[model samples]
Target: MTDQAVAAAVARRFFGRQRELKALRADIERTGLDTLTGRKAPRARVLLVAGKPGSGRSALAEELADGLTDRYPDGVFRARLTEPGGDPVPTARVAQELLAALGVAEPPGAAEDELTELVRRAFTGRRAVLILDDAVDAEQADPLIPDDPDTLVVGVSRGPLTGIPDVRPCTLGGLDAKSAIELLTAFTGSVRITVDPQAAETLVEECGGMPAAVVLAGGWLAARPKASVADLAKQLRGLTGDPLTRTFLLAHEALPATAARILRFLSLAPLGRADAHTASALAGCSVSAAATTLADFAALGLVSAADDGQYEVPGHLVPLLRAQLEERDRPAEVQLAQARMLERTVRLLQSCRAVTEPEGSAARRKLAGLPRALRFPNRAAGADWLRSRQPVLLASARLAVADGELDTLARRLIASFVRALAAHRGAEAAAPELYGLHRLVLDVAERRGLHRERAAALLNLADLDARTGRTKDALLRYRLALDAGRAANDPYAIGRAMESVGGSYQELGDWQRAGDWYGRALAQRLARDERADQARLYGRLGAVQTYAGRYGEALRNWRAAAAGYRRLDDLPGHARALSEAARVQEYAGRPEESLRTCEEAVEWARRARDTRLQAALQLRLADTLDRLGDPAAAGLHRAAAERLLESRAAACEIRSGFEKD
Candidate 1:
């Protein structure tokens, strides 16, 4: 989607921000609208929309960005600087997300400074608008500001961005009476307001002219269409304490018994958003019933229907709901509700992954045993659900771990999340989120002193670090994993950690240390009689030896790997090992031997039905033959390689066509 379209879809309900918008526009104009006129301005103009959490700061900023899309034709980009748990998102992560939206491929594992530079470079020559939402402070907002004259940044925050230079602050308060009444009418209809105009005005006043309060009051009246504005006004007047609180209490009190119970349980929603599945799980009710209740809640404005089809408790109402929950429910009851929700979420997550498994597999069989209500229709639907619920799922994991008593459930949740995400979106695509989940697991493991779980979490996190080029960090985590594994007597973790340590050293260009660690890991695998791991370790040792310019040693290790694979009946592995041996032969100045090795590898690749591998070996043979002064054989091999490539391309085209059809 275009960035402008993304910004426009940020929020759907905007009622009274005209004065704020006008002031923001005037600030932009004062900085020079030269970018709109096809000329460079002095610098990017920043407008900070500051207000309390419930005051609609984010929505106002979104509206402003949406309106300026024409002036900033390059496009608009938006990023949330705060996480769901109200944690400040790291500057690097914010930069990475924004860079992706800007169509820039961020270098993996880049530090904040580098990513900040990339963000600046992306906006350097463009006349675009960027919306930085939920910024907590100047530190979180400063690095993201582009240095381009043609850019505009609208920052949304609960307070002014104190140290940002030249930021025009537009502080928001309650909405105006007319706009507030209009917003209320949108929910309650004009008939009730018209029937008793004075009572309607008094009701809006009781709501303190806050859009959220007005919506809740309007919703209460809407649910009871026969109720008059004066009656509702009198009810609010009778309540005590905070206006918003009183509004929430009155609205909540108006719910049916079951609906009221569900509303109280909604405080358990991760990020204040829940769907039918979770609602059913939380309340121990049927999915359809929960769905109906949620729909009713949406109609009553107790919750709003999100674009993802889940119901979201308005940000302002969340605290009130939480308060009500604490008051009406015992701690034990709350914990039970949370456990029920998480347990059900785990089952649904399992079903999500089971749909992707091959039919008749254990996973699929287990999925079949689950009630139909828990199972997704197919892989596509499951993946879509998983993608849409990503934020909530992550928040669930965070809550589970923080609870300190649901370690087992948290582990299952993380494992299912990892496998499901990998099956649907690939681990690399979801690396950032996976990284956070792993950290939570590690935190729980460390606190509980569970060595095995700690070892596993460490290894997983270390692998992610290595994939993103943080070799030193990976090395440290690998060492810790090794210690944890030893403490827990986990042979698999021990062997894997040793091998990973070697890989990290190899990445750091420490050939001797890499070889030593690989040899150690190889010994562990051999001792444990792990044939597959032993073969893999041999290949890794060969790679390290090759990097060290020890051609003979590399050849010997590769030959061992090839023999092991042959004994194991793994044709592809045998072919790959032979290919590596053949390359080393060439590197060692034995062209004839390399040619012979390549020929054998090609036959093995063909036997393995690996078209790409066979084609690659064929090309390698052609080069070796040409070096050996056999031009005719080289030409034939080149033609054979071309045919293999053509066959592979044709097969891919047919597969694509089938998928499309």
Candidate 2:
């Protein structure tokens, strides 16, 4: 499928997160062409997206760029500072290119100051966007600066750009564990994430949310189908830098005398967050070696892996690699390697964040050439592979964030987990997964300063709680979520929270309270034309009405719900409606009609493989038989219901004479 189509499909997989997306969108909107420049009204806005490598700084920038590009008619100007082969963009050359993009000619081999002036003159009055990706210190971006008062300049870097004064800075961190796993599920599909959730959780811890490491581990696991989450986790735990093991070893060993020492010493980093000077100190090497190693690591896809000169280590082996690289047995002549590999890895991951997959002949070729283990054949196939590699993805995200590297990719990845539930595994079977993911995402979103995401996470968790019989807790969560939605200005989130509150009341058997909340939710949802959720709400409303002994009203709502489900071709919903109709007949003492309805429910349940529904219908059938005075036959049907309920642990339990078979 096309990338946009794939993205749309991926988007459809999310169960929630409307609140956060709305807030993020608002934030993007707040960042007007002039806003990043602040009150000084400098000729140009030099906003910097700063974070450790793998922190998803690039993704966040891309998100803003994706939404804001339309506002700038001069077009978005993007340039790669770090090349795959590990070359830094020369200041003069970069300036020349920027000038050219702005439709200005630069003097060939112009002096640094001249080039800088040339670039400034090129965008004197234009509303173009300049994205300088994979940047180093501010000095490197000096020549390529935008001069126009209407121009917005975005620079993505691994660390703070100390050289740039008066630039608006945002430090990115890793995705939340839940978001990371969700992204994994979204990319890999359901089969993998659902099989072993606990293992997946631990794996997310291991990788620590370094997107590059997460992606690498995911790619590795995806390359092998039968592998378990624990299996990949075991591998991550076992990664050590000693004895020249792992793909990074040969590269490390082959590094030039200066680069090798810097990299080796950087391995001592505890948190794996680093910069060139940090690497130099750890390696006992000079600044030059550290700089060279930064470029070298990018070429090897170990750190910058782009021209950005942003240094980072792979999250997967950060601890183990640091230990091995720091431990003794080094030749006196051979200096220690760097301590900043982890941060470099974070940066590389930031550069490599491709959510909807790559495009174009060049990009396709570039993706195709990614190490066979690294390249995903297609978005669908990649999603399938990613699903199986959830543990690794989570680990990567956690590592990046916990390292305190200012990466936000891990958090974004967590947001995508909503996709994992609805679209990846659907609502019914993936409930447990959805519950845990929402819990984690909620916590992380709040901690990462994402109020909108926090509300969405809370709402999502409340839904799960209500479903699983935690009505009181669900109500509290929903209330908090509603407050958060209001604070974040998310009307849709507020409506959803209202619905969840109503659902909690229904679950608690408080029909009046439930109806009131549902009414408000329905009104809001109706105004929004969110027909997607009408079927479910109507079905739930009907159930509440039936339980409250409003049979006629229940029948009306049930019929409407049934029609909605039929339009959607939802067999399970149809069966539920039929069963509800049967319950009304049974309670009204219409044995004949009840029996017919029960039979239809039974057929539908069988086709739907809904053991719970079948059990409930069987129990209804037994009750009807009892009404008909066939005690022996009633007992047989009751026995069958008992067997089904006990075996599958279906809901609607009854402590009848035949609770067990």
Candidate 3:
């Protein structure tokens, strides 16, 4: 079958639940449409499918959705309400997921109630089907369900959901004996069943009509094409313990040692879905070997191949695999697996940074020797990968924190996440992730007694706070960072904290305090021979001086900054310095000197390709010419500035429209 055909078949696979299916259809029709008004009925639009573990509730829900696709033309959306380990998924997160599927974006860190309202608004007039699978209880499902009668929600769980209004609950049991036999036949092919119908029936009876058990049994039989069905049935009949457990044990024991070990290690993967790269890390083997093992597991029905080329172990089987992993009790092996995964993540993140970082940057140079496999081809691909894998990376960082043994790895992971976020998404969009990562880094640093790391984390948090308009909070964090840096005896950290504190003070409009802090930072940079940092500090000092109405002091500082930038061969810095010097000259009533400096600034801006800077310089030159009573020259400069601004505005509008489209 084609892939679509196979997917459709899987969705429509209902062997012998005719009675339940009929009742479900009846309920959907009865509650869905209003005969009196010829419109959607005013009812709680929920169909609850309740069943035991491995009883195929999820499958039945999918089949029902497939049958009603024509009814819900907007689309069918699915989300798991429980984690792979059976823990309840957070309600806010479920709302976020549903809202995203509905093409509505909620703000970062939005409240649960806000997200719930957004979901409700999204479904207000939409005809959609929401299949919330593996739901733990009604509390988990309440906020996610839309109140719109036109929408339909299918809630699948291990038992009936309570507290939901007017829910039509369909409780399911295991498949019937004949249906179980058909399921096995569907998996193992009809030839084997036709060869020995009695043995197939016996095997179904032994499986107690459980679809999962029957599928695994069929997989076992399918793996051995020459083995007689009668012989397999006899072997099933001879098992001494629970049939499901025995079947799982038999399937697991039959695997080669390497494959079995890989399966056990996969139990540790978050969400029970792992790609070849993750499997390679977990199994401490080559990616090729891991890919082969994952494919083999998919063939054996131990896992399903996800659309993204990852493999997902069934939720019902995760507990069993975890138990088997614990039974093996190889702490050393588990530790090694974890370390390898962390290392692999680190290498991949390094490559992401390398691809996105500016050319000739220290960050790019540091990643020069990264392995080819981990490298991304371009910035766009790297950014796409980072966006797609963000959740996984976040989960891995949380896991590292909980484990505590990989403290260094956790710090590195969080740092890499911050860098990746800043590279792909700007600081504003990355604020929430950066906030979380900085907190995590602080936790790791404090636990490990790494004073320098703690100081760095504090500084980063302070910078984010300042950027987000929390100047007071930023000031507090900067002080803490400075204290920690002093304790660590790191001049660079101390200088950074001082400069950041000055920035916060400047944001608060405290020019005097800002100048003082800048002077202190400059002292440290000079003592450490950090010429680049010293030059930047000089510019910062000049800004505070200019704001304080000290034109002479500001001019002196700007001149020093220009000299420093020239020494460092920084064209943009020199241009900015020249612009500031011209402003000081204008304030000092030296129009001729200001005009000369402004003209020089314009040339430097052109060399730096900073059109905005050039535009500002032209305006400054026009102002100086106006003060000198040269109206004609001033008019020309003003015209040039207006043209530059118009062009910039047009470019911005074009970009904005493109983004909107």
Candidate 4:
């Protein structure tokens, strides 16, 4: 069949709701537009459609949106306010989705209030229809409502959404018998229904006028081309209790065992949505098998396929499936499924890090054994995968922790997430996720009595705090990490904590305390023969000394750092040390010495191919030359610095362009 023909066949037929539709239209006409102002009226008009599950509230709202497409010329925007499992969707997430739909670009970590304000501003003068489907309560719908009078918002929930004001409430129960029969005929074809009109009416009555039940029954009948309407009616009569539940059971029971098992496993998936990889992980099957099962379920009306290749079970059926799963009492099977999913996620995250990390790095080597399906084709695909799966990955971590029996998996998941995010999005962009993961790891470590892990988590959190400029908090956390490290007898952790503590003090302008901590860390590094760390600590200590006006001591430390880096064959480290020494020389009123040091630093930076460092050294050289009465040379250096900076900026822009794609 043609795409248009299929769409027309499945298109929602508005049946037996003329009164509700009329009332909704009247509400929209009365308050949606301000005739006097010739624009959308101020203060949004809300039409609330409240009904029981499967009562077609969302379908009704969509029908209304379709009818008013011309009135709201901007567009009709829709957002699901609840997950399929009936959890209220986080307002921040919903706000982000709406902003994206409105074509507004927001930062990845934007706060809820910021996104809400952005949504409001986006609809300030626009004429549009905003549909909040399956809202858990008024609270979930409040921030999403546009304040503009011209735009209309239709909120569909199971309750009245009483807390929201200026709402026109419409309560829906079920379709009348006539409309239900019509709906069935629309699905089963007019010829079949006309052949047995009485049986079709009996089937509609048996469905209790619930549209979802009627549709599922019709889909069942449509799937069986030779079955008469009497056959379905007789089958319906044999079932007892809620028609919807009975209908759901009938459809579920007809599935093959593997498909049925996959359906149950999907009940445990977050948001009731599963892609092929997720299905494979849950079902212990190949990706192709899982994909085929999901497609079959979609065809059976047991699930819906999204445009992005995700299949979601209907929200109303999630509870039923979960109840059935609970009754099966297969704890071991459930745990196995969870483990498989967690393990797959960890492996995928590892592959994400592998593709994004610098080539030939240890991290990349660690990910060598992953199967082809789990590995991304390139860094861009890896980054996109990480971005798309972040929510489900985070949900998995939360679920593992809550299960309590999967503490080890929880810790690994958190660590893998942190590493993958850092590699793909950079440290600053991934700071928030890192912060949360570190906290989770700390909890898990304490519970598992893993002191070393606890210490590492503390240090990681402190590093993030310092990076984000929370010096006092960083200091406190660093001290705690030091204590944990000592308790764990980990010399490396202790050294790292001491260095971080010193850095925090330096940021707070306490040079004396910074020097003491840096000295302690440097001693440990020296004792351990950690030459690279010692070189770094020398540069750190020299900067503190320079800040405290001990220029002579600072110059000595910087020279020692430069010599150590030179011996280590680290050109960038040597150049950075020379730059620090030059600053100390200038502070000590040694202009000629500082100029020579700056020149040497610039040459080393060039050898390292560090354009940014070269530009910085050129500026420093220009200052030194200006002080030494060489205006002509200073001008040349200044011009060189500008050109280098421009080139660096252009390179950064080009890299950013690739990242966006």
| Top-TM-score structure, candidate number | 1
lDDT per residue as tens, model 4, 499-525:
999999999999999999999999999
The reply for model 1, stretches above 4 Å from the true place, is 1-17, 32-43, 74-127, 571-661
- With a 3 Å backbone cut-off (N, CA, C), the pairs that clash in candidate 4 are 40-150, 41-149, 41-150
Runs off by more than 4 Å, candidate 3 = 1-44, 90-127, 143-151, 160-166, 191-202, 226-243, 348-390, 411-439, 461-477, 508-523, 526-535, 538-612, 621-633, 640-661
Tens digits of lDDT, candidate 3, 519-605: 999999998889999899999999999999988989998989998998998887898899899988888878788889989989988
- The runs of at least 3 residues in candidate 4 whose Cα sits more than 4 Å from the true structure, single-residue gaps closed, are 1-19, 32-44, 63-78, 92-129, 144-152, 234-238, 256-258, 346-390, 413-443, 458-480, 508-513, 548-553, 589-619, 628-661
**Residue 352 shift from truth in candidate 4, angstroms:** 5.7
Candidate 3: residue 335 Cα off by (Å): 1.9
Q: In what order do the candidates fall by lDDT, top score first?
A: 1, 4, 3, 2
Q: List the pairs of residues colliding in candidate 3.
A: none
TM for candidate 3 is: 0.78
Which 10 consecutive positions of candidate 4 have the poorest summed lDDT? 2-11
* Candidates ranked by TM-score: 1, 4, 3, 2
Where in model 2 is the C-alpha error above 4 Å? Answer: 1-369, 373-399, 402-407, 413-444, 447-451, 463-471, 486-492, 529-532, 567-572, 588-626, 629-661
Provide the lowest-lDDT 10-residue window in model 2: 333-342
Taken over the whole model, the C-alpha lDDT of each candidate is 0.85, 0.62, 0.82, 0.84
lDDT of 1 by residue, 521-544 (tens): 999999888999889989999999
